[model samples]
Target: MKKPVIFLSLLASLIASQSCTNLEEQVLDESFSPSISYADIANGTLAPVYALLPSVFLHTNYFAIQEISTDEAILPYRGGTDWGDNGIYLALHQHTQTSTDPNLKNTWNFILQGISRSVSAINEFQGKTDATSQLYLAESRGMRAYYSMLTLDLFGVVFVKNSVGETSKVIRGAEAVEYIKSELLAVEPNLSTTVGPGRLNKAAAWGLLARLYLNAAVYRNVTAQTVTFSNDDLDKVIEYTDKIINSNQYQLSPDYFSIFNSDNHSNKEIVFAVDQRAELNGHNRLAYFSLSGDQFPLPAFPAANGTDGPAITSDFYRTWVNAYGSQDPSVDPRFYKQNLSIYSNPADSCVTAESFNINRGILRGQQYGLIRKNGVFLKCPDGKMKVGKLYNDTRNRPTTPVIFTEKVDFTVAGSDYSTGYRVEKYEFSKKSSSGRNLGDADIVILRLADVYLMRAEAKLRKSNDAASALADVNTVRASRKAATPPPALTSISLDLLYRERGFEFYWEMLRRTDMIRFGKYEDTWTEKTNTDRNKRIFPIPQTAIDGASNLPGYLVQNPSY
Candidate 1:
């Protein structure tokens, strides 16, 4: 799938000179250069789109802010004595500015770049007789549609452009959805059925379409938007899910932890994932975002990695416990595998309830002593425990282990254990440090489990198909070895669906969209309260506003702006 050298050069020029005085001007100038062939331009376009995925980890991006906006998670750090207020975007998101913030702008930029690349690829395949080029062009369309979904969700409007040089045509609401549908339908002929996950395939395009239609009512108030589901949308969702589930290209992983394990990449459970290669591609800070210092296992963890952990709020953890706990909390396995808690123990010998205790040793005593879910807690050369700045008792010092009931937060100033749960998704080896560790874990962007859950949601909404919906939901539950799946899916309310989504897709980047779709976008929480309605889309960036003049209403700020 390697492309021509000219395309590579075009990509290099755009990415390498990203910091130039005027980005739009620089890109526009590069687009007009006749030396670059259409084929070269199309081939080079993908480099930046792939490059953009990694930029989510960039400081100015929405990775952190979007999470804060959703109820699935929240940061404990508020305007406090030692905490950094910059993470305030989380609070601001919950409260104000939906149309244009720096985060919103970055998101807009990210998806547009993705769309641009896809369009470029589409143009490159125009004259090529090669089947591979057509396949790639189709994949590019799917990618654009996927990104356009995000853009519409976050910004309420996004520009639709066909070629690299064309000015964007701003489309909003139904128009945007139609545009996305058109792209997917048009490219279906060329898209391959077998391209594995992380790469968009024909089925994946349908999945996105299903998702878009499922959430249509929320985006635009069609009649019965909340209570009524369109039969057409429901059918599309089912059709798409059927194609993927029956395709045999993917399936649910038997072990919950196996999905997150480094060795289990490319497994059947994963339909697609952002392939993060340490040192080569780009590493997702997911490792750094969800980790807590107190419970972190490695002595060299912080030195080797950035420890800006996002802890689980006590509320969300309680929800998981209430939903799955069978009298004993650890019975679920997912709670233990996906999160770090006081009860987590590293010793493989300790299996059942009685053998496991949160208050065991210096490494298991203090707040930071809690065991991580998947990886073993490592010991120092002196046999003492390792502690981060959050749990480092000044009086006790790092060398000495505080082996008692001293309460200290095991998180950084930028984050707090406001929710009281931190994610343990990626399990790095005891010997590994930083995201560079061969923790070659595949980040599941789409999986069979999610498809099942989504089908249940769509079915329940479409025709009160509670029995069928329950079966679909329970299929996943049964897969998890739940002694008894929810009997008959009696409570198929939106709230229940949300809880199901929370439990099923926790820590994935879908939370913000889920919240928005469920009419919970404007709601308030522990550290987040609605600032205004326009804040829902994020403010159009000041920079963008400054750059375009004739685009008067074209760049009109979202509501409350």
Candidate 2:
């Protein structure tokens, strides 16, 4: 079968097997005729799209690939085997390619399917006017533009279809942007401004537009071309940001951990989150993949290897630690939380000793000690987080020296060892009886903190003297308990902003985009140094190319394919 058809079938199977009930029975009637009223079809279409958003991060598949591909984050120290493959894809995306990869095809197919469903709803409800119908249509358009942005970011071209067929025409970069803007702008007037936290509303649509305009430079090859942000676009960003920030609808949680807790879904910090329901085919990847071998932290789980944890990269970890050098590290809780050190120094032989050594923090099995004095974990030769400890037989031995074979989560309460640092940003603090999958913590997609950083970049680009920009950028730093914001600056560069973003939005999937936008796609690193520039955009999977051959060159493979 064609790739798209195969994918759709896969999605159907997943839904049928995993959903609480048959999706067709709950959301649609398989018995319903193709001639069903357009209004019903529009409402029925929402279930799948809403379901897909949270599932995007269900594996090391799209979530890590999209982020690591850009620069927001990396899976260094070989914690995760697949992250390097993601790195390869990102490197290749920087230039055009004739390469065909199945994973790339799957990502493209899923993203485009989302867009197609969104467009189908729009097409079906051209003149529907019932209150529910209008709301659903607006929501559908907002979602459509959201997915369209994904296409524009990854592929630089997309097929903008109005119906659920194969004859849709391809929309290229600038053209795609225009189409997205039109859809969002049209839906803004009709969308209810008072929607709840997880669902899309007027501000969500506007926020997506802000992102598009903010990255317009890179999207249209204008980042280094003296391109200026249109006043209108800037105004819209500020306008939407202001609405979300001041609407009393959402507020930044005083504690960062509260933002991702299972009980914290309604927290004001979240602007838009993929609604993930547990054990029933929801977004459970973070909780699943992030956990260590389920050994040290929880003694009862099946895959409990205290050593197989996902530690933060040394480079990225340094960015967080450097933010607070002038003062005592003990005073800054962000460091402790963001970079937890649990390994007991074997030589010190002091169980009562401080959780970390003042000089050498965590020791990896490679026998190298990362300097905690500087606040960054020393990375392995490859970019993955260094592995501190490994389990030999899952026998629950604490003192045994396990090899550095897998990723470990040291920050997770039970794991007492670390190669470098564990990402505590999304760490679940509470226990869930339901298979340990009740992390209701709403992942912040676009929070006020990101807005300030984006505005700071815009200001830096506009006004060479960016002392105010520095202040705005540092506001997020201060939120993390920095003594004071990073120093004011008379002038700023993208490098500075890029570092700030790494510190501010690390692990939030903005890294790859930020790196690409700042023209750092070609920059080298310990493991990610030799990536191909064209790999910046993932290949238009070989499967997709073959499926589209019947469309002539309309669906031509991306260059190099």
lDDT per residue (tens digit) for residues 1-561 in model 1: 632222212322444334212222124223747687655555455444544554543323555555656665555452142234454554443555444354555555555656666677666666767776677767776777777777777667656766666666778877888888888888876777777565777767767777787777656642222434568877888887887788777777666666766554567787766665443343444554543333343444434332433444455566766775575444544545422242344432222221222211111122444223233443344444422223332222344442322122223533332224455555454334453343445566678888887888878777878788777776776675423233334556658878877766777667777776666666655555553445556656554554454345556666666
Best by lDDT: 1
TM-score of each: 0.77, 0.74
Per-residue error (Å), model 1, residue 307: 2.7
- Model 1 Cα shift for residue 63 (angstroms): 3.1
In model 2, what lDDT does residue 77 have? 31
Question: What are the candidates' C-alpha RMSDs?
Answer: 7.8, 8.9
Score residue 536 of candidate 1 by CA lDDT. Answer: 55
Where model 1 places Cα greater than 4 Å from the true spot, the runs are 1-48, 57-62, 78-87, 98-100, 221-228, 294-302, 305-308, 324-328, 338-390, 393-419, 429-439, 481-492, 531-533
Please report the candidate that would top TM-score against the real structure: 1
